[model samples]
Target: MTAISIAPAATRIPSRHRITKVMRLQMVNRLTYLGIPWIITGVALVISIVVAVLISVSVPEPGRQAALEGMAYSWAGLSPFWYLAVVGVQAVSAIFPFALGFSITRREYALGTLVTFVVIAAFNATGWAILTEIERAINAAGLTFHHFTALWFSEVGAGSVWLSLFTLQIVIFAVASAFAAVYARWRAMGMLVLWTAVALVVLGLIAFALLTGSAVPIIDWLMGFTITGFFAALLIPATLAFALGWAALHRAPLRG
Candidate 1:
């Protein structure tokens, strides 16, 4: 008799619950990807300024070679503009992955993120570059990327090479992450071509360094890597992220 009694109640999902969950996830992911790079860029710039000032005051105004030595040890020095390279790339990295869900398919979601990424890259890089220039003027080392590269490739001791390695890793990571992110979003052939050209220029810089036996090689490589590797790398991931997003946005439907 008890077994025949009642029917079960149907479940209803609250819209707020769904909205909150998605919002929370997106926010967390945004912070993880965007926050990390931004902080690094800022802190690096600060350290660079301090080190540059210290070098300027601590070292005696000397000959060209001595100036070179001081430049080598200086922090962010004259490359704060390099942050555009980092944060700009990071913008693409943070949002493209989110495109995988396609849940937020407004035109704004698609284009806005890229725009924002570009803005962040540009703003941060510009600010950093300006600050770096100020530092360089104060210190007056006249160092070049080529100079740094020569030290990196030479048979210098580990201490000499570590800074180069750190720089290379940071640069590569920023560019790679940007490329990967762009790839996840869409196939922007024009942008890819631009990046490819940029990367090639980097290669050219390398060639120039080699010809001159200067530190410029690393800068060349980084330039080449950015335009070429990252320029095009963004395309592939962008496609995947778009495809998945499209699928998710469309509810299950019957095949015609």
Candidate 2:
């Protein structure tokens, strides 16, 4: 007879450690955390380089004018990474059920999901910082390269720039996760009602602003805050979104 060995049940790690393990599990073989960001950044940088070279060689006149005018480049280079929010939705729809089947609790699922979003956001922010520095160096060397830094971004300090980017991405991911949780719990009917209410509130706000002539003042007031301040303010909403999302996930149904 072969010898058999068994471990004691009391030897298992604590629940918090188990939850963290669940969180790390999501990151395994995951592309949203770093892979998609690198792909988007690489493609955007390649396109920028090619376009800059082409304009320099063929349409040198406009290129010269733009360089002289101190025109900023597109700040939308990393916008593609924003789709990670949608991926968050899909993760819940797909991963939550599988995780539940494996005996993971609702809290673990929610916390793991949150950690995954923050990690992805931070990784992208780091990539943005690296690209921004490279873009500045290239332009400083008189190469006329304008890819990462916009005029607005240039006005902000480098630390603020990266912090704002990281904070904004986290807030967006949190909101998206909440929206996804709503739909996952309520399905199509719930989503329709949610969107309808959102539209009505938005329209009412717009009408009120136009009627009262506060739109321009509102815009001006908004523009007064520094980017860091704006992102810091968003933290409140982000917290609410995360809370709501976690609550929804707590009672959400699982399906194949």
Candidate 3:
């Protein structure tokens, strides 16, 4: 006689434990992997200030000098957020294979990655909020430096500021994750096809709008929403992207 034991499927794939494991693994290389973008952003900020100062000193025109005084270099700070796309891409392109080696199921990995990205997005949004407030205070003190308080970023003293930032980050993260999953399953050709498909869709939409003479109405509709509302609306696409990304990764093959 032989004794045998079987565990339920749910026990085998407990969502909480699996997600925790993935999150822990993600944190292991957090410094080296996550810190690179922040470091580069800091260096760029310092360089831009130095360059601006040099330009201000050398340029002779009074109007040009005044224009340079309160230059809204908000785009500079935002450039690093794009690096998060690379982070998401690496999460799949690099870590997904390693996680699979540990026998983590695709469902668990995908959910865990989503949770991890949300947390990262929240963390970044909080930091950005703090920086934004600090920049505002500096401007009030007549420093004229604008690091985080761009017109599109937030309305002054508005509560939706953090929400808008978080929403934006989530949408960007979801898009990156979806793209990475596509690449993981299909590699270089997949990315090319994806880009081409996106281009065609955009072009087709433009043509349709032009032919229908509905471009103004469409633009007007878009203009009706506040920035926060517009970004909040992106949550729908973000959710869709997450679902699609999970589906893609579910059967995604390991790649080098």
Give the number of the best model, judged by TM-score. Answer: 2
Tens-digit lDDT track for model 2 on 4-83? 77755557567788677777877776685567767777887788777767666776685565753343656556565567
- lDDT at residue 48 of model 1 (Cα atoms): 52
* CA lDDT scores, all candidates in order: 0.45, 0.76, 0.77
> Higher-lDDT candidate among 2 and 3?
3
Off by over 4 Å in 3: 1-13, 59-61, 154-158
For lDDT, the strongest prediction is 3
Question: Which regions in candidate 2 have their CA more than 4 angstroms from the true location?
Answer: 1-11, 62-73
Please write out the lDDT profile of model 3 over residues 164-256, one tens digit for every residue. Answer: 778888988899989989888888898899899889999999999999999999999999998778878999999998887887788887754
Clashing residue pairs for model 3? none
The window of 10 residues in a row where model 3 has the poorest summed lDDT is 65-74
- Residue 127 of model 3 has an lDDT of 74
In model 2, state the lDDT of residue 137: 80
